[model samples]
Target: MRYLSLDNQRDGFILAARVLMMVLFVLFGWQKLAGFAGTVGYMASVGAPLPTLSAIIAVVVELGFGFLIAIGFFTRPVAIIFAVYTVATALIGHRYWALTGMDQYMAMINFYKNVSIAGGLLLLAVTGPGRYSVDGK
Candidate 1:
């Protein structure tokens, strides 16, 4: 596609990117909301500090901020927040170095996945949410 044509599609592309990135958070957040006790228990089992608080934060960040991102509202700052949150989750929840065998392998995979998600969010921070967003409006 030509530069101008592609430029016209910029908003569409950004919308796709923004929504796609938020999917994981939104879905997981919903799951957490549906199973609050289980979520807290899982967090405690993972040795997360203040399991209840962490679970609450997870639901807010994932569902709340994730919704904002989906609608392109406060996209830039929210994306940065998501990026940082993603990295923190990786460090706090996926400590592969403290595990062994298959558990270690899964943690390693999850850690990298969170890191990769953070990277995408960082890019979204720079790119903004394009013309289809409230911020863009």
Candidate 2:
């Protein structure tokens, strides 16, 4: 009975997790869209190759893939892509070794956070979007 209850709650929990995780990406993507030039500048500052294009990709990935995940469309593949993107951003944008002291500390923190998010995304890829999603588990 209890086990069945937990199983029944699975989809709801997955939905909640999907929404919560995607919120950050969507919000960040919106920020990038709102400040396109600034996002390009920041990408350049982070030494991202093809800064303008990279910024555009970031916005698209964060918003497009983020939305897809939130709505549970093509969830598995998108989660995998999002995980890779997250890790790539961690490596490219958060090169803590290049900085010193607090700056380095902060960058390292952000880098690990990105990595953590990526891990969660991979888990989502494995677990799938559940019955609440368009993918229908």
For each of the candidates, give the backbone clash count. 0, 0
Per-residue lDDT tens digits for candidate 1, residues 1-137, read: 45556776889999998888888899999999999999999999988989999999999999999999999999989989989999999998999999999999999999999999999899999988999999999
The C-alpha lDDT values of all candidates are 0.93, 0.96
Local accuracy of candidate 2 as per-residue lDDT tens digits, 1-137: 25456776999999999999999999999999999999999999889999999999999999989999999999999999999999999999999999999999999999999999999999999999999999994
Query: Which pairs of residues collide in candidate 1?
Result: none
Report lDDT (Cα) of residue 15, candidate 1: 93
**Stretch of 10 with least lDDT, candidate 1:** 1-10
Off by over 4 Å in 1: 1-5
Q: Where does model 2 exceed 4 Å of error?
A: 1-5
